[model samples]
Target chain A: MKTLQNFLFELCGEQLPSGFERMSTGAKELLAPLVDECYTDRSGNIVGYRRAALANAKKVMVEAHLDEIGLMVTKIDDNGFLHFTNLAGFSPEILPATSVTVRGVRPLPGVVATLPPHLLSPEEQKKPLPMDKMVIDIGYSAARARELVRVGDPIVLRQSCADLLNHRVCGKALDNRAGVAVILNALNDLVKMPLPVNLYVVFSAGEEFNGFGARHAAWEIAPDEALVIDVTHGASAQTPKNKAFPLGGGVMIGVAPVLNGEVTACLLDLAARNQIPYGREAMSGRTGTNSDGIAVSRAGVPVGLASIPLRYMHSGCEVVDLADMQACSRLIGRYVMQGGAVHYE
Target chain B: MIDAIRELAGVSGVSGNERNISEYIKGQILPYVDKVYEDSLGNLVAVRRGEGSRVMLMAHMDQIGLVASFVDDKGFVRVAPVGHVDPKTTVGRPVVFENGETGVFICGSKEKKEPELKDCYVDIGAADRAEALRRVEIGQTASFLSNTFETGRKIVSGALDNRAGCYCLMETLRRVKNNSCELYAVFTVQEEVGLRGAKVSGFEIAPDVAIAVDVTLSGDHPDARETTAVLGGGAAVKICDRSAICSRGIIEDLENLAARRGIPVQRDVLASGGTDIGSVQLLGKGVQVGGVSIPVRYCHSAVEMADKNDIEAVIGLLTAYLEK
Candidate 1:
């Protein structure tokens, strides 16, 4: 039997942009070997099914978003610079001098431009340039740039998953791609054992812009319950204690008004029984993830959220501990395979 | 009453982590009420059976505090505010964790720019990350360490904003012997973050009349914003706040009860801020809703002050109204 960690490492794919997640195709290929059936929904979500042996078994949906924050080209300037706006939340301060991959007629490399300090006045040096003021220099003339790229083309930060100091890895778009990896790994493990519930593994799309994909997916599937996996802020020297978690602390279980109390307790109890390390996240209002949209979908499905701690979110050098991802996968796999009779209240 | 307020104020019950305070309150109110239970959202619901109307009285049991999100290698812990935690009141303050570990809160920068809550950290005196992990785990909450003290006729504590209301509710539940209505005294959860607990419990209870007992800002200080409520001005009968416009019938009924019983009352019109009354007003088939507020000074800070007489007035008015 193959270990879950090995299966997850094999499932990690290229970084995907928000609203343009081709990760579903890669996910389908990985899931093809394990599940009984697989398909894609209208919203571009990938669904894998493992039918329960019993006829009256409850349907459970486990989902993770396939989208990541990126930028979109708005205009090309006379100087061959491309003006862009963010597809999701991005700190303007981190965009300067960052490398990007612009998907146009052909993939093109570009770098965010920064004004020289010598040319700037003292007051200008004190403030970071706004997103509209910043431009991407693609080493092309205005006419050449127009031929190579068009307005509304997606541009993603260029970074590959690489090892960091403490069993951690740095890359772009780890916020949700890691979550996708967890679902794939968990599903791979579940196929090895007898399943008690009808499982639906959905790799949802367009979570960064809005939860359109998750909302539609939930409405269509109408599962008894849902578990959403995403990324939460990782602890850093500068990050606030309450808003972040340690990179390797374990998976975070969300506690919020929208999340069902009994389901959350079940997940926590499963983690404790399995000796899996986990943390608690207190979401007073909206969870700001796909879970928010999925919770109120249709007749209101009970939703639970599990998040891996990620550092420098929406930046070029986003980091997460690989061990945390594995832990999250293990917890999900155990809960789905062994979680007995979940009661929603 | 003072002892109950002090005891409730001393316990830490940050939003989403109200188990400690909820259990404490369950123990205290279980003996007085006919039935006591907790909701799935951690709301402590105690019932006193009677006749006529089913009345729901709410006071949130949770308070604002810092939740440890991350711990660095050097033992410094990063925290996020559970509610509206002002950075000014957090710096240099001693914070106590749920596990009895204490830490000193500090800001990461020494610059003149106002620091956001994210720019704060807690130093728990651990030598390294491993030591810090031994004492505190990620996602654990730590509240400001403050002791209730009396100056003149006022009492000051860390969580007086809502715990004082909790004390008022418990005291009313104990004192009201001839209640004409079926009373559901609910100590709600997660009110510091939003009116979350009240939202769920209100939908379940669906009472005939609802009243939120909470602390409202008192504009008696020299620097306070313009408002009609003042310190030691008796119970502030809410006409309206940001949360809800108190039902006219409920407001008049409370005022008439106070007038007949000779209990001191003050009319309040808060410009901003909210209570659970907003959620209770919108629950189920709708219900008559109002608020009885204890005017508090320096709310959402380490030192929140409430007058003893104002607290007494709230308890007396609520008890008299229930009896009627």
Candidate 2:
């Protein structure tokens, strides 16, 4: 495995939409040396350990899911347009007018095929395009496309991840890639910074779909405390003040759920101690992260969730601030090194 | 527009207690209005001179509420609802008495499954009816009780149905410019019941145009339609409703005005319900009428929501419309 020196753009996998298989490969490569050892389970989650990295240390699991949400090639019509069944939750309204690529025998670029305005009935234009009525045009004939495309082949959208008006970068596959980046950076920093606890950096997988990877990782490496880092909504003028996090603001520490109180407190304390400008990740219920699986793992593990605010989350071309990533990396690594002991009531 | 919503939501004007809300509007709008007076019914009226075309813009000050009708020997007072209320929301809700005594709302028939008005009662910290009378009168109308708190941004989750409209007008007064015709911004009372405040205020202002500012439902939540305007989509301009069809020219003018200027606007033909414009139209000579609506989610609940951006958008459009 190539040790990626620059954390910038190492290919998690050479191909696209192969979700967990690709993402877990990226995570274990980062974890290979930092832990006692690392391995991928059947579900494709890469779990690594530095068992008892410290004396009588609290066993803590830090997870950032490694899967990216995408579509699956269900059918390819002769005109080369591909019909897809969503591998994850996605609204069809936003699906139209977006570019996508199919990963098969060969990678092919395509546009989602939408009905021509002139051909549509008067009623259709006035309403949103419903799901199942949409298609992707790969611009190929049915026979040639079918030979190249399989039933379960993954498809990825081509959303450019670049800086926007501010320091905001727009890109596709950010949901867990941002989380993957956080885990990689933290693992590298672990060697430089000794810790008071056993830190098992888990790059969980399949969270975008059924959370299969997270569940498998939870059972395989059950830790006392789990800290799952994922992306939440970032600020836009359209975003409500209460429900948004600004891009430049540091990582958002989840506090509202109360399941991860100790971990959240530790993250907050570390951020404050380290002079990190952090924000609150307030949600009323489950964080909808791998933390959800890790929270109820075994006899119900207590969990904390830290979120990197990304604009247009789950949607392609999600935007995140690099400052948030750096801050999250610093906060998690330092907190783990300081105290691994957790006493939850 | 912000002022109307803030003032309306912040005040405790549930019903008969609208006196304080009425007093606030009277004070703020008295000087700017052409002729200002309070009706025998306590509805406040402010008339800016109307010349070629008259206009009456209304916001109801009162909300669905309970009136303390009887006090039990244990100081538990039986109350009556003054307007349309979901018996469901009132159960377990906190309410304040006329004398500032706070109590939890409970139903006498918890086992019955469905509670009628007689089954619900308000318990104050008192020993008897004689003592309860000192704090609450029989005619004491208590409006929907909701405290304003900020969870994020500013979330004031109670009783904003018409108060938001009232705030819209108050902001209009603070920002509207240019006066070709008379503009009547009336803070009417009892609109939740039968648009009573507008009935009298309209007769008094009797301008050619009538517009009501109030809350409209925003169905843009998860699983909501894209056509459903969101809290942040912008101000809703009423083109027609069950009560009345908005004048075509007025609708076109506002639409053109919004397009000419960069204001976010959504067109609405309310599937049901009526605004104070209905009462305003019926008051004397019918008035050319329209409305500016705030798209809010959960209109009657503690978490009623409107987008700050949409509120600001309405403010921009109103300023432009009033300026000339």
Candidate 3:
């Protein structure tokens, strides 16, 4: 029996950098068996459907972006050093002296160049080096570098998903992959019991670059109600109290104008009744997630955001707690079992 | 030599991040030399044993560029200039990170004063701090986004300043068949950052005579007339720069060797700027030093142009002197 940790790690390993989501064969394989019918949409979003027990059932969509933040090659220097740009934003600080894999004709190993502290001046040592000074050194000369990599080739931080102490998992691409795992876990349980509504599980693409994938998935499914599962900043000493949630604090239920009031109420009620730990995140305007895109799809959607607390988000070592993920899975499962029939007074 | 310079210009080794350039140089010089290895500061040192005085040939591998110093809330990356990057040249240019993440180097339009490093930022199309932090980090270095192209008699590209010097030494090492003097062809690191790499490698291999194969400022351009060196005039034999004065004996030897070999050459006397010769000259109890400078137009900027004939002269003169 494969655990949720195994599933999440496997999903995280899929190097599905934004705009390159079509290369997600392994992630699709892991998801195909858990649903009644699985297919990929035009935007490269992987959509799965599970039919309800009765006829004329309400459609409920659960979405998690499959795309991860990465880099793209912009130029190959004469000595075969690679110059690149960000696919999505990340801190410029963590990039220096880091190892990465250039997804070229074949995956090639490279390192981000950094000045050794000894080489830096006293004033320079206090300052951060600029991104333009950084170049990916693949140890190839110009002729050979051009043979292997072309401009626009995707590059990802070379990191492997690993289980840490206290059921915490760490690696690259865990931001929304962890969300995808929660949906998969819920599907595993809901498959055993008959669902009241037709469940639509969408592993979306292009959420990091833009919310186009989620918007496309929501438009196609046209779900009456939607639940978006993505990662939120996990509490760390570096983060402020309101800025981040605890890693083991279960799911973060987003409360914002973008989210449906009734749906948010029902999700909070379900977690309490099911004894699942959850925290509340209040967004004044846009949730800065697929929830914002999904909520405004077509006419409109009564959408809710359920986010797992993830630490060190968008870096090579994003951390998430398995217990929190399991709790999120159960809450979503219970929501489906109740059919998300939240009626407004 | 032109091909070598073009290839060397393609690798990014901004001061400290010199591994790629170092490794590329090692591969090229390895098969020809008796022994080749990298020193602690990432300098590629290749040697051919001989019975005469140890002649250390130095050329730095690093170039000038920018480093990510800070990231603002809106995903705009602030940069600190690495080496001697002119703020004027950096604006509106594209820069690429070591991880292959490229960004447009820009500055605040509202500032009326001349653009400074603090006012500039790299926009990688990141929406916010969190988004930018996902792909890049502070302290990661970036080099200018440019290509190596030849226009008629001149080859133009970024990093050509020292890469031209590197090519000359590489060609010299390749052509020199006999081991007369013990040769130390040291491709150094961090020359742009106060010649730090040369300082280390120079101390390690204290030679009887040292020669820095590097680029000198050319005065052929319309805006510049104060410089003594000119493009197409042949290799510039260094007399004096702000950093180090050439040894009288080495300068005479270089001039005599160039004249004997029928190689065209010019005298280089720069009012400012320095190269590996500056640091390597100070090594040991005391060492005699000079330089063979490839006269380059627009020394520090992208699109720095070097004459093919001058590059050939540098390679020829170095080969002739080494074979003697």
Tens-digit per-residue lDDT, B1-324, candidate 1: 667778988888989989999989988888799999988998999999999999999999999888899899898999988888898876888999989899998998877588667779999999999999999999999888888888999999889979999999999988999899999999999998989999899878878889999999986789665355788889989866656645657888998999988898887766568899777664433466789999998888878999999999999999999998
Q: Listing candidates in order, what is each one's chain A TM-score?
A: 0.93, 0.89, 0.97
lDDT of 2 by residue, A2-33 (tens): 22223424422322332325423445666687
**DockQ for each numbered candidate:** 0.01, 0.01, 0.01
- Residue A34, model 2: lDDT of 73
CAPRI verdict on model 3? Answer: incorrect
- For model 3 the local lDDT of residue B141 reads 94
Clashes per prediction?
10, 20, 49
TM-score of 2: 0.49
Against the true structure, what is each candidate's TM-score?
0.51, 0.49, 0.54
Q: Residues A1-345, candidate 3: write the lDDT tens digits.
A: 567887898887778877568788977887788888999775678999889999988999988998888776756777788876565655678898888989888888899987898999999989887665568999988999989986657788888998899999899889888988888888877667888889898898767765657776787678898998998899998999887999898888999999999899999999988899998998899999999978877688899989999999888999999999999999889899998855534
> Which candidate model has the greater TM-score, 1 or 2?
1
Which regions in candidate 2 have their CA more than 4 angstroms from the true location? Answer: A1-8, A11-24, A33-36, A53-56, A116-122, A341-345, B1-324
